[model samples]
Target: MVEIAAWLRARQAEGTLRELVDLDHLGHGRVRLADTEGPALLDFSSNDYLALSEHPALIAAATEALQRYGTGAGAARLMSGNFPVHQELERAVAALKGQEAALLFGSGYSANVGIIAALMGRDDVIFTDRLNHASIYDGCRLAGAGIARFRHNDLNHLEELLASQPVKGTRLIVVESVYSMDGDRAPLHELVALKERYGCLLMVDEAHATGVFGANGGGVIEEAGVASGVDLAMGTFGKALGSYGAYVAASRRMIDFLVNRARSFIFSTALPPAVAAASLAAVQLIQQEPGLRQELHQRVALFKGYLRQAGFAGDLGPSQIIPLRLGSSATAVAAAERLRAHGLFVPAVRPPTVPEGTARLRLSITRHLGEAELAAAAAALVACCLR
Candidate 1:
């Protein structure tokens, strides 16, 4: 116990230990809903890129589902809670992705963990992006596969790594369609070509791209025209769909194997029927409501254009996620504080979530922010940065 406390203290001293902040019951989008420290703020820290979290259509669906199915799933999926709504959503997801089958998970984290750990083993080699999400990294570790990293978005490095490594076993390449932190894109076609050349299985995490990328918001894979070639695709409903839970789109054989073997799926309580129902409604919206996706694309373009015009140069990837590099952790936190003071609520992303010396402000744009709100945010950020 003494050694553990000392280690924690050392970590803090080294600026490597994380400190959590109480967000104080905030709403989604660019507004902090509630707080004890000061006034309510306009939120820009949300991952709800489509602002569907509070959409009337989704809310209506959820409310109706609640009346029909109640709150909890009551048991694990393999047990009593294999709700019909779950099967409906899975089928909808599969059709939307043009896949043979889809399997649902309680969260994106679990889907990645269960899929990777179940599919790969000590006899496999996993080639992951250097900036892949923690969940993917954790999954690879848990799978006990030999791991190697290609530079972020660098297909050349990935190919070189694949060719140079003398490691044996099945090769798996993992990447995020749109990286969560950097708001950059992976070179999907080039990576897919590499996989074909090397005979490797490719997995894509569409957590941040779902509902904002593809024609039907199938995510980066669809946008890149490689949806058919992807071996496994992971997505979440909590972001653009304005609902909760996640699913994997893959072959029927893979789904069956996961249903029977993935410990995370079998051991955990199934997603509540209400959540599945709401997600089904959300998917229907994605299919039928072209206006929402259009509006979201416009929002992303407007924000990125504003950032570029402001000379706030950064990666500014082709997706909604944006990051403003502030260099030091203290500076990033201070910038968020300044934004909050100006009635904005952007979160400061620090170490552990990001690597050292790369702390910055993560700006998540949504369809909810009108022109006035965006202009105001731009002005506030300009003021803060200029100061």
Candidate 2:
């Protein structure tokens, strides 16, 4: 206990200790501190890119499923937890991702860990980005695979690492389409070509790109027209879809392989029927109402424009997730607090969420914010973040 206290004190002294801040959701992309009487803050911390979390259709689907199927999947998927809704949702996801089949997992963490571990072993080698999600690192560890981490989005470095590997060994390359903290996109087309050249399997994590990029909200792979070249397209409904679960779209054979060998999927209880239903409804809404994506991009542009107009010179990147790089953890935390005082709730991102010396505020834009809210948030951010 004393050791743990010392560790926590060390974190606190370094300005990296985290605390939970409870907020009351007031809807329309606004929230307020649960214990405070301050005005609602413009929410820029959510990943609900299309603002579909509160959509009526998703609500109706979840409500119906709950009333009919109960509140939980009472057993593991291999036992009695599997439902038609789960399978139906997988089908929809597979079709949307332009794949032959799909498999569902309880959460994105379990999905990534299980999928990667199931696909590789001690004899296999996995190449991933240095900035890949932590779950991927855990997965690689579980697999006991030889791991090579390339610099972020550096194709040349990736190829150099790939060329040094054994020709007969199983090789897999995994990366995220859009980086969560930096908001930069991976070059999927070039990545596909490199994988093909080296006879390696490619897996693209589209957790941030799904429901926001492709015409049918497929993901960056779809937009890049390289779906056929990639082996696994992994995504989560918890973010853009505003639901709780994750999936991998791949060949029928690969899905079957994971079904048999993926311990996380085989042993864990299936997702609640209502959760699957909600995801399905959200997917349908994304396809039917394309304007939501358009409006979101426009809002991003508008907010970025306001910042640039205010003489801010930070790189906001190409996606909805914007990082205002404030040099140190203390600086980033202070900027976030200042923004909070101005009615904006932006979290300060720090190591190991980001690398040391690269702390920033990770601002995620969603369609829920109106033009006026975007303008106000931008002005607040500039005033609080800039010198």
Candidate 3:
């Protein structure tokens, strides 16, 4: 206990200690932090891109499911936890991604970790993007696979690494459709071609792209017209769909293999039937309403324009997740505090979420904010940074 206390003190001294900040209320793109007794601030730190968490349809479905199936799944999925709503949600996800089958996990982390560890082993080699989510890296390590990292979004570098495979057995390449931190997109078309040429299996993590890209929210692979080429695709409903849990959409055989082999899925209790029902309803809503995507993009564009007009320069990519680099963890935290003072809730993203000296403010855009609200938030951000 003393050693743990010392370790925590060391972390605090280095400005790396983290604490949980409760939100008294979270809705309508604002949150009332428990520590603050003031009104809710405009939230730019959320992952609710489509703002469907409070949507009537999702709420209704969850309510109905709760009344019918109760709250918990009671057992592991392989035992007695697999509910009809679970299978129904999987089918909806599979259909959305244009895959033959899909399997659910507790969250995106479990899905990535379980799938990678299940599919690859000591004899296999996995190539991943350097800027891929930490979950992906954890999965690679857990699998005991020889891992190689390519420069972020650099297909040429990826090819060079692929050509120089030192140990080769069941080569698999992993990348995200839209990188969460940087908000940039992967070159899916080029990656698909390269994977085919190199005879490597490809996995695309669409956690940030699902319900935010493609005509039917099928993500970047579908937008690139290479959905058929990618071998495995993983996504989370907790983000844009504004629900909980994750899924891996793949061929029927691959899904079946995971069902039998993935320890995370087999060992963990299944998602509550209410969550499954809510996620299914959210997916259905996303498919039915394409206008939500359009509106979200428009707000993003407007926010970016505001930032550019204010002479704040950083890589604001084409996607809704924007990162404003602040160079150091201390500076990023200070900036976040300043934003909070201005009634904005954009949190500072520090290492190991980002590399040292590359700390940032990860701003996520959602459709709930109107044009005026976006403009005001952008102006506040610019002012906070300038100060």
Q: What's the number of clashes in each of the models?
A: 6, 0, 0
Model 3 agreement with the true structure over 1-387: per-residue lDDT tens digits: 479989899878766678887886567988888876787788888889999998999999999999999999999888999899999988998999999999999999999999999999998999999999999999999999999899998888999988898645899999999999999999998999999999999999999999999899888877888889989989998999999999999999999999998999999999999999999998999899999888899999999998888777766888999998888788888898888888888888888888888888899999878888888888888887854
Error of 2 at 192 (Å): 0.4
C-alpha local distance difference test of each model: 0.84, 0.92, 0.90
Q: Which of candidates 1 and 2 is the stronger one according to lDDT?
A: 2
Model 2: ten consecutive residues of lowest lDDT: 378-387
Model 1 lDDT tens row, 225-294: 8977888988999888888899999999989999988889999999988888889988988888878889
lDDT of 3: 0.90
Better of 2 and 3 by lDDT: 2
lDDT of 2 by residue, 196-245 (tens): 99999999999999999999899889889999998999999999998989
TM-score of model number 2: 0.98
Q: In candidate 3, what residue range of length 10 has the lowest lDDT sum?
A: 10-19
TM-score of each: 0.94, 0.98, 0.97
Model 2 misplaced stretches (Cα beyond 4 Å)? none
Report residue 82 deviation for candidate 1 (angstroms).
0.5
